[model samples]
Target: MPTARWRKSSYSGGQGGECVEVANVAAVIAVRDSKDPAGPKVTLTASGWCDLARRIKSGEHDLI
Candidate 1:
């Protein structure tokens, strides 16, 4: 597979937090930890990624 073009989350500034990076790799969406580029990653389908994004935006999985 070709190398993914990663895009870092804007919310991840210089401050310390769970930094995330996302990329579009062919038919799948690739996700990884910005702090651990060489570590394990997760790949999800386009529909699955959209569902997850929708859930997150609607606060359906927010923990406080």
Candidate 2:
């Protein structure tokens, strides 16, 4: 497989704080810490990615 082209969110701060990078790897969506490129990564299927995004947008994972 070709090297994944990771991209950070436009909303990410430039201060190098909490942030993540995402990439499209074949049939999966790859995610990793932006501060730790060589560290572990999470891979999710297309459908799973969509669900996760929806949940996030709906504040299902929010801590109040």
Where does model 2 exceed 4 Å of error? none
TM-score of each model, paired residue for residue:
0.82, 0.88
Q: Which lDDT tens digits does candidate 1 get at residues 1-64? A: 2478988777777763478888999999998887888888899999999999999889999997
lDDT of 1: 0.85
lDDT of 2 by residue, 1-64 (tens): 2499998888889875579888999999999998888889999999999999899889999998
Stretches of candidate 1 off by over 4 Å are 15-17
Backbone clash count, each prediction separately: 0, 0
